[model samples]
Target chain A: MSITFKLDVLKPHQPNSPTLARALKQIEGVKYVNIRVEEIDQKTTSIIIFIRGNEGLLLDKIVEVLDGNNCALHSVDEVTIQDD
Target chain B: MSITFKLDVLKPHQPNSPTLARALKQIEGVKYVNIRVEEIDQKTTSIIIFIRGNEGLLLDKIVEVLDGNNCALHSVDEVTIQDD
Candidate 1:
């Protein structure tokens, strides 16, 4: 089975979005990563993240990467699972 | 606050992936959508979905879209919320 996650994230408005995208794409089974800015505050930026990967989608690993970059996880908006 | 969700989805191997992506992108506050195939069986395909959008992400609407297409949502893998 494969899984996909749609995440809402908050991050400081410094590190480029591509940095986060590259980090997420590096995860095992992660096939694609896309980040879009939702809102821009004075210091923080709200973003939506989309990730596609294999069955064993590592939520923790993704968390670790985001946390390491000082990004906070807000909420999980959607999930989809595929299996034969 | 904005929210993002990573979803694992199951879909039949007929409708093109872009169709789903386009449908998702049409959602309000949905800035981007990415879908990737993980495993392909004889009849089904495992896919991972990533969606980024504003704070008021309507999970039900997304579910409605997937259900309308005969797709099943298996799990929500990740959620990130961004707030100032």
Candidate 2:
């Protein structure tokens, strides 16, 4: 199955969107990742992330990566799954 | 060049998201399109549309199709262009 996720995340400035995107893309089944900044504050940046991947995508793993980058997973806004 | 656009749009329920996506895909040079509904009111649905295409994509044509389907283009949130 193919899965698509829309997530709300808050991150520190260091890794940045491109760096985060690259990290997400390196995951096992991820095909595409897009991160759009929604808000920027002194300490953190809020982003809307869209990820397209296969069933191998694990929410826990995604959260792990975000945690490693000093980011917070605000919410999993939407999830769509399609069978192959 | 490859272009990616994030747009805010409002549309009536008739055509639906999948239908609108199909219509947009038919436009010349379009490669990918994704529409996520953000809000739904009594009369309209607000959506965030992400479109990835080549340089041939014309904003006017996109607007024309949306107009024909009784949709309104609220705002263009972001635009990214990458040179090949």
Candidate 3:
């Protein structure tokens, strides 16, 4: 089974800064990561990360990675898996 | 691939009034619906809906359901599929 989460990340000191991409990749059990950047409050950039992992282990891995990163849990929603 | 969206609802006049839920189910092409509610700003409710459907048809169905509900698009994330 798979679970998906939407991450609202603080603006990277630099756009495309690898801090998030790298941190997420380091989280054990995260099978895939797709990050999109958005700006809210005009000053803070929100990094939206899409992730998939073992249903039993995904949230712990995600929370670990998000610790101390100024990240917020926007939402977590389950989805149908696409083979693509 | 499946796509999922997070919605920020502007607090229904009544919680669990079923307007949002029924409106969502009315949208064609939504295969599965799971809605979780959150409250922010002490008044507004944020709805997190999880759905499964044709990979190509999910978003349009969701958007149509969300139309004119004082809703805001929070984020859309993807995930791996689980047969369960």
Candidate 4:
């Protein structure tokens, strides 16, 4: 069975770094790792990552990757264009 | 007012293409463009592009850009891990 997870990340200072990519694939549950560059301010390339994986394991791996990379993930905002 | 638009794209075969990057910035309503490399399959590097722009104009420009780039975006899934 396959499942998808929303994983948005910010790469403000490192857009071409493959280090994060390598670490993400090391996780056990991650099936796909999609990266989207969302915002750039001053010197940051904010990005979003979409992944497919087992829920618990994916979250665990996220934590591990964040720790290893010394980066932090953002809380997803459930902002739907609700009334139109 | 400022807003964020989720624009996920698949760059199946070209991860280093800067043309898309350049084209995206030309849209009038676009506030920012972020890219994330989500998956790598054989000869493709699937990526996501997150953007912020005026609702109507953004959609219009997206269509124009897609027409120019020959890419299609997928319907965003409202797949929440509903019950956990």
Candidate 5:
């Protein structure tokens, strides 16, 4: 069983997008991460992130990771679950 | 100003420690991550992780990342803040 979801995130403009992507991929069961920048300003960048994993995604964990990265989760846009 | 901390984490035995190390390093301001195995069983592995960052480290974000990786945080052992 696995699941996928889209998240809207806001992060500071330092660490860069690729770093965030790599960080997210380290999550257990997380197989893929696609992050697209939607908006950027002097302080922060808004991104749309899609994550797919082999099981139920942990929302709290995701938030914790983002907070550590100096990022914020705005909303969960979409989700899909597949049982295997 | 920067801060460093040590975390005790328990995770499933699939994703290697290096992966977790890489993930933690991606957090903004995080300059280094050291993860050592404390114990391992058939189902999970216990690890001690140290993270150093350029500023105050966000505990919430670390937890989120851990959760996504299917890991649980047991305790935070040490902390140091350096102002530069």
Candidate 6:
């Protein structure tokens, strides 16, 4: 199975999109990660992240990574699971 | 190159999500299509569509198909192009 997620996140500027993407890519089963900055504030950046991975993809781990980075997950905009 | 698009559309309920997805899959180069209905009014349905395809995917053709189905494209939320 392959799972794809579209997540909205708000985080401080320290871990920019590249940093965030790299961190997420390190997660088990993660195959693709794309982070787009939607808005920028003096201290924070609002971004949309798209991740595609296999069945090993766990939402809990994803959330944990974001939390570790001091990022707040606003919402999970979309999630799709497809059988390979 | 492969492209992914996230589109917001509003249309009558006649051509439901499944119908819409089938139509979109017929487009050249489209490999995956997922449509999720977010809101339902008495006469219309608001949906978010995610499409993945190769370089052959054309935005004009997508819009044309939606227009043919009387769908109003509210916005294109995201677009990503990646080299394969």
The reply for model 1, stretches above 4 Å from the true place, is: B1-84
* Poorest 10 consecutive residues by lDDT, candidate 5 chain B: B75-84
Could you give the DockQ of candidate 1? 0.04
| TM-score list, all predictions | 0.50, 0.52, 0.44, 0.40, 0.49, 0.53
Worst 10 residues of 2 chain B by lDDT: B75-84
Write the residue-wise lDDT of candidate 5 on B5-75 in tens digits: 67778989978898888888888778889999999999999999988776446777888889888999875
lDDT by residue (tens digit), candidate 3, A50-78: 76654344454676666546565554423
TM-scores computed on chain B for all candidates: 0.93, 0.95, 0.61, 0.67, 0.92, 0.96
- For every model shown, the clashing-pair count is 36, 0, 1, 18, 9, 0
True-structure RMSD for candidate 4: 15.4
Q: Which candidate tops TM-score?
A: 6
Candidate 4 residue-wise lDDT, A1-84, digit = tens: 545656555554542323454456457755445455566567655656555555445465675676567556775432121121
**Which clashing pairs does model 2 show?**
none
lDDT of 1 by residue, A2-76 (tens): 557788899998677999899899889898898999999999999999898886776678889999888998755
lDDT of each: 0.79, 0.81, 0.53, 0.54, 0.77, 0.83
DockQ of 2: 0.04
Q: Taking the candidates in order, what DockQ does each have?
A: 0.04, 0.04, 0.07, 0.04, 0.02, 0.05
How high a TM-score does candidate 4 get? Answer: 0.40
Q: After TM-score superposition, what is the CA distance of residue A37 in candidate 5 from its true location, in Å?
A: 0.4
Q: Write the per-residue lDDT of candidate 6 for residues B1-80, one digit (tens) a residue.
A: 99999999897977755456667767878878777768778899888989888998988999999998889899999999
Best by DockQ: 3
| DockQ-based class of model 2 | incorrect
Kindly give the stretch of ten consecutive residues in candidate 5 chain A with the minimal lDDT sum.
A14-23
Candidate 2, residues B1-84, lDDT tens digits: the string is 566778889999889999999998888899999999999999899999988888667667888988988899875555554445
Cα lDDT for residue B1, candidate 6: 96
Tell me the interface RMSD of model 4, in angstroms: 10.7
Q: State the lDDT of candidate 5 residue by residue for A4-59, as single tens digits.
A: 78899887875666567667767777776666667777798888878777775687
